[model samples]
Target chain A: MGMCPEHYIDYMHDYLDGDITREHEQELKKHMQSCVSCQKHMHELSDTVAFVKSATHIMAPPHFEANVMGRLPKRKNVLGIQKWLRRHPIIVAAAVFFLLMGATLMASYPNDNQFSVTTQPNLVVDGQTVIVPKGEVVKGDVVVKNGNLIIEGEVDGNVTVINGSYMASTAVVSGQIEEINETFDWLWYKIKKLANDAMALFE
Target chain B: MDALVNKRIKQVLKGDQNAYADIVNLYQHKLYQICYRMLGNKQEAEDIAQEAFIRAYINLHSYDQKRKFSTWIYRIATNLCIDRIRKKKPDYYLDAEVAGTDGLDMYSQIAADEQLPEEAVEQMELQDRIQYEISRLPDKYRSVIVLKYIEELSLQEISEILDMPLGTVKTRIHRGREALRKQLNNL
Candidate 1:
């Protein structure tokens, strides 16, 4: 359980960590030849160190970046967010960004609907038609998919639609209104969303 | 390189979220490896690694410009790992999969050297046993052992990462290695 000559323990460890000087190493080698206990201790400790150093170098999982970026929390301030705003191509092309989001459908319906709309609490829903009925003041984020989004009322938050038409007859919006009909717009939407978010810092 | 990393940190602090991505990409593997060795679970390691980066991002204002960003981030991750290890009951995550099916193994090493299959499997088992023993180490000893042998970091760098005196680091490494040898002896 212990080195026979207790100080030899330091010699063994320094030797194992390769932190020993040539002089000390020679002394350690010379001592180990005649000292069975220290020799056995050194051998066992070397095995442990070697075994540890042999561990495999594990890489981050395949979706590491997406997981980090997708989970990057949103900030309420724009200037606090814009420095990263244009990092798109100057940063990343965000090509994969659009592709991964292709599966997010209606938050409430959970893919039951063809439209990938976010959940916008309060409003009107009739079959595939969703409406911010005129005069009705809807709060928080809203998304529409599969069916058309008719905005005749006032929305206090952002409105976004995916794979569906958006008709704003008399809609008064306080935030960004994003309508995505193509994957290309997804890229544009990303930038515009940042810009829109960036603008909030100034306001 | 550190100057560039600091600049990127400044950029991120100024409102560029994308700038942080570069930092994440650069250190993800290293941090992930540290977390994996420390926590012994791929899922928990990934979560802690990501948490470290996000925490750094949110607290960029407090980062000391004079410090090496790697050291700073490593400290953050090391602290997170210590917190995680100390919070859990002993051996709670012991069976959370110590084998790195995704990466290297000693069997492969022995096979590469053209050793016999029986010897390779035996060595592989020994290696696996060593990893599990490391994961089972007390938080203090495990930290020093992982930083020294697993990461091959300098004793000084490990001191900076763990924020302890150099002598304490050496003592822990000695004790940690001793503990590992004892555990492996039972095999």
Candidate 2:
């Protein structure tokens, strides 16, 4: 019988584990008696197992429980909105999708009532008067409807007046000023306003 | 105990915030031991263990009552330990030395009055050597060995806690034992 050291080492582990059959156990025991290296290997393996089994148990530091409890975040109310969203991810996703959809639809839909206005302080409209107040400087487009434009300041942009008039005193206008009083222009404006209001509802 | 833990969990979910303390107290020692064995640093272990409990508390509603609470908590702790290990630079020699001093210092003090000076020192040295070697093991093997030997968990339970197959756990354990044997031989 060829008794290899490596083979014996494997058998030694099985033997220690009590998984070896009687026949194999007998063979291994016989080999151990004749093989010095295998005997040494078995002894070392056994010692290692013993050391691991006998290792000292280290307890957690004192006041470990108190420390942990104190450090714990204040328990959040489980019924909070964040917890509810966590529990119902599908509902959260739906809510997000609807929110984004509404924003996109609102952005794309035309609203004639809502006109883009320049944020420059020079373009000021108070009630029916679009006034470029004295000593003020405007640097963008100005559109006014159903109101008069009073200019006593410097204007550097286009001024459009619909169903209204413009008056300037020592005011510098850098862009064209137009008044839409023709029937065709009035008819076009009304048609465009009606179409926009209808689109706003779908949006 | 499991039934009691489950009941506490139910109370906690139902707005009894104080009930969580029972759960933390029940598992703190075991979780700390696992962290200590894995990190080989008392301070890091405490921090990680405490963090694990806090995370578990926050996510308590997500915890399925059908599952064993111990397994769930252990998984959280083991994951936190692994993340910490990965983020750290590999410093086997430095970590082993620091761990040796910290661990040996405490044990040596305790054993000083009980045993002869020379014998206590020798025993403490041996324990330090074992700890250093254990710390030197690869993360995979170290985790399995700590869970199996120190934590005294069953192979099946370890498998569940680690989210690993039983066969893989066994293989790692076998490899870990072999590595430790080599370290012991050198000693």
Give the Cα lDDT of each candidate: 0.78, 0.76
Q: State residue B59's C-alpha deviation in candidate 1, in Å.
A: 0.8
- What is model 2's DockQ versus the real complex? 0.46
Instruction: Name the regions of candidate 2 deviating beyond 4 angstroms.
Output: A1-8, A11-34, A77-79, A85-203, B90-124
Q: Tell me the tens digit of each residue's lDDT in model 1 across A1-203.
A: 35366777888888776788899888888988988888778889988888788887889998887788778877657634554555555444465554455433222223344644556666778777788886788888887766788889999888888778888867899988887766566656666666878999899
Instruction: Please give, for residues B1-187, the per-residue lDDT of candidate 1 as tens digits.
Output: 8888988988887778899888888889999989988887788899999999888877787899998899999999999988887775553343344376655444342212122344444566655655566776777899899888878899999999999998889889999999888866755
In candidate 2, list every pair of residues with a backbone clash: none
TM-scores of all candidate predictions against the true structure: 0.58, 0.59
The C-alpha interface RMSD of every prediction is 1.3, 1.7
Candidate 1 Cα RMSD after full superposition onto the native fold (Å): 19.6
Q: What docking tier does model 2 reach?
A: acceptable
The candidate scoring highest on TM-score is 2
* Residue B167 CA displacement from its true place in model 2, Å: 1.3
